[model samples]
Target: MATGSRTLWKGAITFGLVHIPVGLHTAASEQGVDFDWLDKRSMDPVGYKRINKRTGKEIDKDNIVKGVEYEDGKYVVISPDEIEAVFPKTTQTISIERFIGANELPFVFLERPYYVAPINKSDRVYALLRETLASTGKIGLAKVVIATKQHLAALVPSGPALVLSLLRWGDEVKTLDALELPPAGRGNVSAAELKMARQLVEEMSGPWDPADFKDEFRIQVMKLVEKKAKAGEGQTVLQPEEDAPAHTGEVIDLTALLQRSLKGGGKPARKTPAKKAGAKEPASKPATQKKAA
Candidate 1:
């Protein structure tokens, strides 16, 4: 009985010994300045029109055709059929390839994320995908062609919902080994400094809480803009810049610490020894204040 105008992308999730039909709906959106070309002279609307650079004339829209270039002087014209041939025949299913451990790749490789939801009495199957991934501590690697373009996506379970993050191909990401990296050498480090560093970290350590942090810049910007608009000024105001604390970290000391850890136990924090549990020491008897008569 859900109403209103939100259409879900109907699809089927596929994996070995598992296949579930589901639908994907966008959980978020980018709502910002939607820029458009304008005519400064006329103060009227300006729009895009097809113009041939070589012909020096505006070409009719119907006459235009999409083409792809392979070489300096080679090209291939692509029709609607040519493009459709590559897309999944039905838009009803997003086929999942395999599930993988979340930490198998770094965050840098993650691209854009979308919320995928179930559609039309598909909650049971949707829950299956969500709980299965959640229990395994893994994300599903899947291919979904939305519109005419195919996407390499990672289906990550986010609470009761699922997040599909688009991924880049292996070839698109350049190999790190091919690049010149910084030297792995670790210079000598003081034992005292290392101990202090350990103490500093211990002082600041706490459990992970995602809700503890947010984009302060974005929130500040929104507030500032809102305040300005209420005062009838539409201009965007930049916040005053704050200077970062001086970084006195030396490269070698860090590397040495890392190596020490890898070689089993770098250094433990010096903590005050706790009093023996359940063994209360006798209270110190204060000398009775002798009255000097």
Candidate 2:
């Protein structure tokens, strides 16, 4: 249950009269090769420029204004002051609205996940909350404001840690009615076919090991890069200045918390299996790889 070095947001988890101070750390990282735009001749980095779309001329930054479209070829201009006034207030609290069964949440609504770690001597209360959720098989439906935007999030107990998973708003998800999908519940399928399908699934099903998957595209691209670098064909690109690190508050002793939770009959975290050596590519390229290419 090691947390990330940097905390993106410092907040408190609140439900009823309980308050547990916590910090949100990014749980995921973007995976892929990042290609930067550069001037071919000078090898200088190229950046975006604001331009007047209709006039075909570059525009000064001061001339830009925010607006929303009301109708065709019409817009309602909004000033910076107005936008700031309407922005959601940063309450610095993950306010739990209600609790729902673990299975009740749909996978489609899940957007991003962050590790919620206890901070400022709130480990006991955090552990209590995590254990309660785990024992009851429930997840807290909460709203949290981060970077001035309010997000619908699920407070889920993940082994020794609590995960704050951001969810898309109800209206953000489109209805499936427009698609011509087959009717639900065994429509036009034979008993023998169903039996075979079940058998295949049972045979293939095993423990969920994340190491089983690998980003083949990234690996291949990195291999190509290494080959070119070894041949002295690499260019020296200037590195951009890094942003100041976010304030990481007091670190919690997760090991002790986990031990206490497990002593209360909580299950231990699952161990990830070692990745296979010399993994071979699939016989055919996967659909994802094809799309990426």
Clashing pairs in 1: 11-92, 11-93, 12-93, 12-94
Off by over 4 Å in 1: 1-48, 88-90, 183-200, 232-293
Residue pairs in steric clash, candidate 2?
none
Query: What TM-score, over all chains together, does every model reach?
Result: 0.53, 0.62
Instruction: Assess candidate 2 and give its lDDT.
Output: 0.60
Q: Residue 79 in candidate 1 has what lDDT? A: 61
For all candidates, the clash counts are: 4, 0
Best by lDDT: 2
Deviation (Å) of 193 in candidate 1: 6.7
lDDT of 1 by residue, 1-293 (tens): 11223446777875433466765543334322233322323222233565554444565555555555455534456665876675454332344565578889667567777776554344554565577778989877766555444667777889888777878755455434433335565346568866766786677788999899999999999999899999998866799997642312111233443345345432222221111101111112110100000
* TM-score of model 2 (CA atoms): 0.62
lDDT of 2 by residue, 145-173 (tens): 76656878888889998888988777666
Query: How does candidate 1 fare on TM-score?
Result: 0.53
